[model samples]
Target chain A: MSTGYHVAVVGATGAVGTKMIEMLERTTLPISKMTLLASKRSAGKTLVFNNQSIVIEELTADSFEGVDIALFSAGGGISKVYAPEAVKRGAVVIDNTSHFRMDPEVPLVVPEVNAHALAQHKGIIANPNCSTIQMMVALEPIRQKVGLKRLIVSTYQAVSGAGAKALAELAQESADLLAGKQPEELSPAILPAGSDKKHYPIAFNALPQIDVFAEDDYTYEEWKMINETKKIMEDDTIQVAATCVRIPVFSGHSESVYIETAEHADVAAVKQWINDAPGAVLEDDPSQQIYPQALNSVGKTETFVGRIRKDLDVANGLHLWVVSDNLLKGAAWNSVQIAEALHQQGLVHV
Target chain B: MSTGYHVAVVGATGAVGTKMIEMLERTTLPISKMTLLASKRSAGKTLVFNNQSIVIEELTADSFEGVDIALFSAGGGISKVYAPEAVKRGAVVIDNTSHFRMDPEVPLVVPEVNAHALAQHKGIIANPNCSTIQMMVALEPIRQKVGLKRLIVSTYQAVSGAGAKALAELAQESADLLAGKQPEELSPAILPAGSDKKHYPIAFNALPQIDVFAEDDYTYEEWKMINETKKIMEDDTIQVAATCVRIPVFSGHSESVYIETAEHADVAAVKQWINDAPGAVLEDDPSQQIYPQALNSVGKTETFVGRIRKDLDVANGLHLWVVSDNLLKGAAWNSVQIAEALHQQGLVHV
Candidate 1:
């Protein structure tokens, strides 16, 4: 290879992995070599990058040979199996699964909030959960300006976060529903949680559960938000609570976020902090009927925040509406951002 | 009139008004005569009540001459103009519009929570806003069991709350979107808030604004939740904050509700309280993947409560998912229930 580093994208055919390729194409990171990897099912499939056709290679123990970086998004099982293998082959793995996120040695990083944590990476850097990633980008400004005391968020998540299959399911189910098919008559093979035994129709409906139940009856998605926020912000003292709900939207995730800051900041100052923050766009003029909307946030890389107001009762409490494209900023763009950060910090070379 | 009340339903052709007619048909209150009233534009229409086709009459100041109970739901403007006229014409008004909900003279009643307030109504008993009514039914039991200190709720409201025309707008916009039309290409006349200057599509997306902005940058819908909760519970000391959102759901309104109780209560006690509460159904079974889903709650009169869990940090903090049919329990049924309470309390006479 030339002076640039080699990069491999596992799960190259999946939803987020597809966007990861697009992000890689647009990213300024120098790449003399690119490797597209996936499971055996997608091994022979070809995807385009830089106007060149690239054949997908099956991920294996030796697939990371000479690779400077490997971005993994296949699933937790695949990540648990192949991530360490990739790392052993001298590739820094940026894992996009829940498998290694909570590992004490694994640095869960959102470059906007915790890029410095990349220095502590021991070959594996866990990308924070999609919901947590966007939230970190939106709230890090507030956390930096005024110490965050507590956070309570209710998410209006889209089906894309579940994967490409969930997106197809939403499309098919919605088509079936609009054709006058009874909801009970339609079969939903995947939704809410694919690993879970049950499936529900997500077209024109809201599922209060995202992933399987974890400790204290919270879903793994909720726990991911709660724990990942702490890990990313690097402050376990900030109490976080989350209710993750899957709405019918296909791409963007919207959140109704409530926060209690350690210090009092007026709405104007808070807006200014968000306006000044990178990767965050303020869309909050109520007089002009301007606010962050799910449809408007689609295809956008920035986190859109609006409806910022102080709590009528609590002096330090505030509320905001946050929206972002789950596939872009929440998953693919974030992983690529980490890779860019790794490159900028000279941590990409193994 | 034959030992029964003569009931008049204003806005008889509306989504809630149609449900009100259905509710009256099933109500325990004896209605000897039913008068259907609407605007002059809908005056020539006919609606069936109790298997009888009733001719719709244009609502005027003289429409409630002999009516003992007048249910006003056309709009806030109409209610402001006609509710007092109905009451002056010897009728007890149960207004479903927000025109008089916060009036000190008009008692805001969610019958299950504050039916006793009906006895003090000065010829006008106000039904709380659609979003507020369901929340009251779910939380009143908890408030009674362990005093509520503070509540923060984020609502996933339905399109029908905007009325019949908004429902039509959603259907058309959804069909156009499904046919591969761009979001901007579709003409959306009503949504988010019709009276507001701008409109947004509600098909497969979420809008953070539910109504016009009010004081402190809160939407009028959010303020309705905050102010009406205290009014209906008759506890001005209970601190409430709300973020109201309009989602793609057709009927049911779902909320992510978090509350801090005055005293400690475990999950089991909270579940038991919800299970025992009138008009509240407990659907929370985490292992079974059961929660209050919007689609499943459609057309249901009772508010479904689920996803009940304690906060990981705060001892007294609790969270719940509450869903209800916005047209039924949230509007018509709640108003009819209030009428029943007034009848049972011997307060229906002029």
Candidate 2:
């Protein structure tokens, strides 16, 4: 029998944090103790799990005293401050922030793609960006079969990736739009880029910018896809470019990924490889009009891939559509999966 | 003094045909007489153009006998049968169908990109695909400056391009969804491909397949973008690829275009080209958080360009976001532009 261990849930009141609790309930890892941690503002809130009410405690450096593992998802700053403290207190940290993803010591883990990287983790395992995690699950199988040379991805991301308030913003904005309110006067508080001074409505339109713009005019979200893919795959030679856009949907994230394989690839073989790959479900059937769609993918842990096609001009080029529930496979469940992998592989001890 | 041309509008009752009438009212084309023609089923339908209700007459071979210019937005079958008859009767046919776009005898024109090609037209001028027209308006200036070598475009197209009923379907489906209905149960009668057996919902979703799958899994809409870009730009050497997707918006179409310039290109120079180019507007301003948005382009006749950035990997590659009212610059205005061009060049006589 697997040993039951003490666990701490950081940022328990936020969006991904709540999902982390939901995922932890469904996880295979045996838990003897659960500590719900949040900012002081949400400290007194109670959340129910497994027919028990867990009163949230304000997160502090001392909160991880008896914790075996801690899941962090509040924000980068919270992770940067409390993650190491949780680690120094003898708990393994599975971070869902961009904080330590590129750090040499923290293994950026996607259980299906690079669970092996978990063995080298030094008390901290980093969960990648939501967009990167889904793409990794869909493409890692193909990358193993036919060596990858280049990747070009464009995303149709949902508003839920922004946060819970952003979700409320979209809901309110959409209701306003339906009730004859102008899109301009919708009073958007958080969208396109949350930290930026201005915000745009995500109702009935598309925003080509996501997160803040970074170097070379690429958004930080796009950069995360580029940088995290290289780090997680452990191959920096691969050419990756991305254009991430925000759409009006609430949950699932969809991607249009184009890749140039080193070897000449066949669609039939690619489809077979995807079907057999772990965490990937091939939903492509042009005749029956069966394909992966965003709304159809919500609430699922596995990534749904479809619309596979070969480029006419480029001999070895291939295109695929990928969709997944960003909150689950992209963030919370991914962090929980890493903790589970650490337990499954005997990489962590309470 | 400029002379007015006797103009004939085929498919007077369709979505694009109605827009053509509205555009003609605000057009520079010196139209002396207007004849509204449609399929027999719509013959008696009355449409108001220039504050006058003109009954749509049944389209026939003799409909264009006294016309100097015939703007055709009818299906390709009607254009194929009547366009030749219209041409033989001394009328220049500006077809918005794919029938004559690839013909060696026809000039596929996006006036801002290649008005000179009109001089060699054999009485037929094909208005390039809707998606292609907007991209051309955005990119032609950049192409002229640095010379384009490659293009990869992914579109977020509105439902209006599918037809009037498709627009109604979107509105109805969205209303149903807002009323807390299941998205899967929403009946979709027209989408991705109208003629194809299956239809999918466009309310709060994105359909990657547009215009049915063709050779190598590319949709015919995608092929239209690829082929029409080459034809209208008059450059077979430029490598182009596209993934055309249908979104929930009603009218404007947005594209995320990535291009590789032949020469080393600078972002400032590229912005200048787009600003100075006729029929194109630049909206890029990262500091001010400004960019071309799809909804903002509705009912506008000019293409909006923004979010331009040089590729991090390819030294000469750049990215752009192009948006336009697909009914305006993409079809109706482009057709009217051709008629105005012919009139200004003294090729048309009232």
Candidate that scores best on TM-score: 1
Predicted chain A of candidate 1: TM-score: 0.98
**Model 2, CA-based lDDT:** 0.88
Instruction: Please tell me which predicted candidate would have the highest lDDT against the true structure.
Output: 1
* Shift in Å, residue A228, candidate 2: 0.8
How many backbone overlaps does candidate 2 show?
0
Residues B1-350 of candidate 1: C-alpha lDDT, one tens digit per residue: 47789999999999999999999998999999999999899997899998899999999999999999999899989999999999899899999999998899989998888787887878998988988998988899999988999999999998999988888888788788888999999888788788889888899899988889988899899899998988888889999999999998788999999999999998999999999999999999999999988889887799999999999999899999999999999999999998999989989875
Candidate 1 per-residue C-alpha lDDT over A72-168 given as tens digits, one digit per residue, 9 for 90 to 100: 9999999999999999889999999899999999999988888999999999999888889888888999989889999999999999999889988
Error of 1 at A327 (Å): 1.0
Which segments of model 1 are wrong by more than 4 Å?
none
Give all candidate RMSDs, comma-separated.
1.1, 2.0
For candidate 1, give the lDDT of residue A289.
90
Worst 10 residues of 1 chain B by lDDT: B113-122
Docking class of 1: high
